[model samples]
Target: MIEALAPVFAGPLDFARHWLELAEAPEPLPRRPIALSTLLEEEVQRPLMARHEARYPGGDRRAALSMWTQYYCAQYLLSHLGAWLLLGRMLPFRPDDIAVLVLEDGTPDGFRLPHLGAVAEGPVDLEPLIREHLAPLFQSLQRHHRIAPRVLWTNAAVRVSAALNLARQQPDVPPLRLLEAEALLAKPCWRDGSPNPLHGTQSRVEVEGEMVLRRRVCCLRYMLPGIAGCGATCPIKEGQSAKPLPLLKSA
Candidate 1:
């Protein structure tokens, strides 16, 4: 399956390689699947908690860790699940088929993310993808952090949107049809620039000339000092009125 996708995703693989080299390296790299819960505990939460304690010295290390996990997990979903989110409309897959990239680093920060590296040959189901994979990943996060599901879900919408936006960074690297994106983008939601319908907190996605996403909720990336500046759309500064959703149906 991956070899088939190599033409779309890998530029070098897309090329005709020398016969000798192709013969020598016939198989792709190996991948080991780990449960989402195990990945969260071992890779994300533990390392972030420890690192936050050492770096910040004090001040709600647990809370900081929790916040960072919300931020990080969304990326994991984005990077690994790009195939599902962006391309699933065409190349079908399932949660069980998904695997997190086993990495030497034991952290969930941007640099050390466990990419969604591989999927086995199989049929795909969107509902199960949410049920088996996304839901469990979030459940593990809330369980570990003792945070409310509302907060996790709210923040999760942002992360999901970020993943969608990020996938466009390399424009169809995985041979995605983006039927979902096209349908979502065509909705009346983003015309006024509001994230009302809250499909991944994405109020808007522009297709031609400067593809962009306008998020409804802030990721709270601002609260954690010295990351990157908060986006202009961030609700942190002046407060946002996503409460009574500016409009619906137009959504």
Candidate 2:
């Protein structure tokens, strides 16, 4: 049954059927409000951090949590939100509507999109879908996590950017029509320093005589002491003078 549904999904991602049920709310919403970020941090983010720290050892606890929160947040965006970007669809943005699935390690596994069956079923347009449905999700997440709307959206775009690049490399599924996906990216969205998706529909970047896909924001992954340096895409790395955004360079 799962194999049959694989093609419709983004790669290196999967969902637990039970998590999907919880996200859907079972026709009776819970007594308490659902706060996605809080839920994820407690249930998913912190756990993953603990696992990583256990396995790797050495790092400031608070900083590790922050960095792992950013990393898993990016992973969540990559698997769930990015699936929509690849399909050019949208998911519901309400507090109760957005839920994440995670591995036992607390890494983001995938997501459950309540009331988003139609979009998942396909044949939808990307631009209107993102603006109407997704934009609101970022706003809601901002409220829940107390993170900036731009920061949340930027994390999402970064994962989307990574997913597209991964798709190009693997080509296991039909290659994402990047040019077409760019149309969705071209639509105005927010990021740390601007009101546009930092990735802006392109993935690979050239920096200082090298091609790199720099993270538009520091995942804060480096702040955890003894953790490896920022990812290849980090704009704040040693000797890097660039501000982390405005993704593409002129031809």
Candidate 3:
């Protein structure tokens, strides 16, 4: 029976492989969350700071390192949750539905969402499931100082609604299309500062003084150029220019 299910389990194995590659160190293998966290801190996070300090002589490397460590920790927890989901373990909460609350002291407070419940082999009710399972996780985070007071929900209903409205104004635009476009615009803006102009349908402007242009292309640009609405001018257009763009470049 396990052999019969091997094909079905291949997807999880593949995902695990990809994650392990990103982790890169021998220490974090076999998917242990605590071990992965430690490896990430030592291998990835610490190295990032050391490189940053070496390259850019000034600025608070310590503060940047601290922030990145917190972010990486959150990401590690989320990745562990994903691995557990792949293994069929029922999670105590849904990280997506709940928001990450950040306190003034830079700790995570808790999460908030509609109630949740475990469903049997029939139809599922997501609302109650979120309340029962996810809420407790949020409460635990709050109690443990793993989260802060400010909440950051994974579901972007408000942003999605706004996007839908914008899409409605334009004829023949799909919801997925709008989302891809928005993500492309938002990612670089948050990560390295300045939105990737290619994602924005609007015309580009040359801002005076201290203008930073971080040349980044969205994944959709590589995977689904046709859906991205770039037409012949798609970033993935064949020949020399089709090559993927780098995420960062120094001014």
Candidate 4:
């Protein structure tokens, strides 16, 4: 199946090559398959959380979920956003068409796409990826754990911002695609005019001689026992941190 996506993964987009899998057979997968949508179920989430908590005993449940969101968004969105920004393409990002591969420790390893969905002939907006994919997933996580939707959106946005940063640094990226990437960050609303959760989740700041990302929302990783926070990129400042709770409903 990966052969069908050779063109999409070509050039600078190959940086996200490991974030998604287009396998010819399922027999070789290193982890068990869990439908991304099924993550909403308590029965499914319980054991997954067990394996995850086992890895870091005594971590706060909400913090553990937040940490998981960071890992998931970073890995999955790299491939999704990379393809969108670099190639005018949309991968099989619909939750129904993808599966999360869970490692023995219950961290999501990567996504399995049924196939490379399609490539647009011209510009492609982010509505489909957001409304069709992230929104539902965020809703599920929010309903399950009562964490704010913004936390997950911000987690996802950090990855999108990172992908944009990479795209900007690429020497071979198309000029029009760069414009599209800028437009994505600039747009304050989705196609339906709803507030875009990703609009301002990250920004570039000069640190030393190089530009680095600063996140707008902390991932609550600091709440976990012994887990290091995001360090320089974290929005939280000294002596002012709080645990994440659902402040607003999921969009």
lDDT of each: 0.43, 0.47, 0.31, 0.72
Better of 1 and 3 by TM-score: 1
Error of 2 at 61 (Å): 8.6
- Model 3: per-residue lDDT, tens digit, 110-188? 3222232232343222232323433344344344333331221221112222333434454444444445434533443
Task: Name the lDDT value of residue 150 in candidate 3.
Answer: 21
lDDT of 2 at 94: 42
The reply for model 2, stretches above 4 Å from the true place, is: 8-75, 81-95, 102-109, 113-123, 127-150, 170-177, 189-209, 238-251
Model 3: how far is 131 from its true place, Å? 2.4
Ranking by lDDT: 4, 2, 1, 3
For model 4, residues 1-251, the per-residue Cα lDDT tens digits are 25554554566666545556764555445677677878767788878877786655555677788788878887777777777766667888777788887888889877877777787888777677777887888887788778888778888887777777777776777888777766666789877788888888788877677777787777777766556667667777631344332232222
lDDT of 4 at 76: 73
Q: Is candidate 3 or candidate 4 better by TM-score?
A: 4
Per lDDT, the best of the predicted structures is 4
- Better-scoring candidate (lDDT), 2 or 4: 4
lDDT of 2 by residue, 1-251 (tens): 12323443433545422223334344322222234545634453345456644533454444444444455445444444444544444455443556554454444444455554434453444544344445554454445445554445555566566556655654443334455455445655533234554444234687678887665555454544345555567666541423322222222
Worst 10 residues of 1 by lDDT: 15-24
Q: What are the per-model C-alpha RMSD values against the true structure? A: 11.9, 9.8, 15.1, 6.3
Model 1 off-target regions past 4 Å? 1-35, 39-48, 58-63, 84-106, 109-124, 166-176, 181-215, 238-251
Ordered from best to worst TM-score, the candidate numbers read 4, 2, 1, 3
**Model 2 lDDT, residue 151, Cα:** 48
Which has the higher TM-score value, candidate number 2 or candidate number 4? 4
Q: List the residue pairs that clash in candidate 1.
A: 80-116, 93-124
Can you give the lDDT of residue 191 in candidate 3? Answer: 38
